[model samples]
Target: MWVKQISVFLENKSGRLAAVARLLADNGFNIRALSIADTSDFGILRLIVNDPARAYQVLKDAGFTVSETEVLAVEVPDRPGGLAGVLDLLHDTGINIEYLYAFVSKSGGNALVLLKVEALERAVEVLGANGIQVQDYHIVHQI
Candidate 1:
């Protein structure tokens, strides 16, 4: 139904984020998408990588508090309003998106948007009912 995401606690200091990215990059983990929620002290770096298990291990081994979460990945047209259309649909259905980030899909003409919603099951059901496509694990892994 969705992909596993890595949430890394990072300090706001310079090079803290780079250290995490470098660790993943050096481990052959390809970052598909990422988002950062920051405050004055620290940040939560949400990441979708090629290998979630391995990525988690790498980060954990490096002494970082990392957690995995299930997130929805939706494929949309790579044009303007493509994202808006989906958001609008969700809004109209009373679904609230907590956060979202985009990634280039392996599927040529489409883009992947990783979303966190307030209600997981309900959101999926409503999105499907409204003709909005939600990506499964197999589809997301391919890209």
Candidate 2:
């Protein structure tokens, strides 16, 4: 399954992050997961929201630098080794993961992984062949 992620380039200044969040809130976007990679002068705000296209548009309209990226959303068991198992499958298939982050369900019984890969199609194929379910964009965006 492919999910759209919004990557926003932000300066290291107060209210910058809040402005972005407020824009999304005003546009009716509910963020599902978020991560920020920071540097001395700037940061990258990576987010997965309910409405990615709209979120991107909102950010763009607000004068924020943004980009849309396709990523994989995978469901793995909450128990130990579940994530490892999935990674092992990908590694065996020679799929290189660029980056990944996790979000847990309310019950803490499941873990959803947001993954960026070098080759999306091949990653999906290999993961699917290994009995790993790849969530559809529809389902992912809704969640």
Candidate 3:
């Protein structure tokens, strides 16, 4: 299943990150997971929130450059080589991973990873066939 991810384009200025956090907090949106990629002048803050629709609207209304994307929340074992196995499965199936970042490993020794691939449907199909646990939004929230 696909999870909604919010991506906010932030200027590389002090307090911008805190402002977003405070806004979300005030709006009663809890951050589930987050990642950021930055340059000298700007950054892309990726987030998984409790309420994506609300978060998107709130960010847009506040004049923050933002967008929503579909990504997978994959469950991987919290052990050595666990990630490699998943990567190998995708690689063997010709799935191109755009980027990935670790999330809180709170699922009883199973780490949740936010993964993005070019071929969404194909990747989902392949991973499903291979018995990989692709987490849905409900499952992600509990984790």
Those runs of model 2 whose alpha carbons end farther than 4 Å from true positions after fitting are 104-109
Question: How well is each residue in 69-110 modelled by candidate 1, as lDDT tens digits?
Answer: 999998777889988888888899888888998866545567
| Cα lDDT over the full model 1 | 0.85
Q: Model 3: per-residue lDDT, tens digit, 5-68?
A: 9999999999999999999999988888999999999999999988798899999999999999
Model 1 lDDT at residue 24: 86
- State residue 124's C-alpha deviation in candidate 2, in Å: 0.9
Model 2 TM: 0.92
Tens digit of per-residue lDDT, candidate 2, span 59-130: 998899999999998888778998999999998888888889875442235678989997999988888888
- Model 3 weakest lDDT span, ten residues long: 101-110
RMSD of each: 1.6, 1.8, 1.2
By lDDT, is 1 or 2 better? 2
**Angstrom error at residue 67, model 3:** 0.3
Residue 21 C-alpha lDDT in model 2: 89
- Give the CA lDDT, 0 to 100, for residue 124 in model 1: 86
Candidate with best TM-score: 3
* lDDT, residue 25, model 3: 95
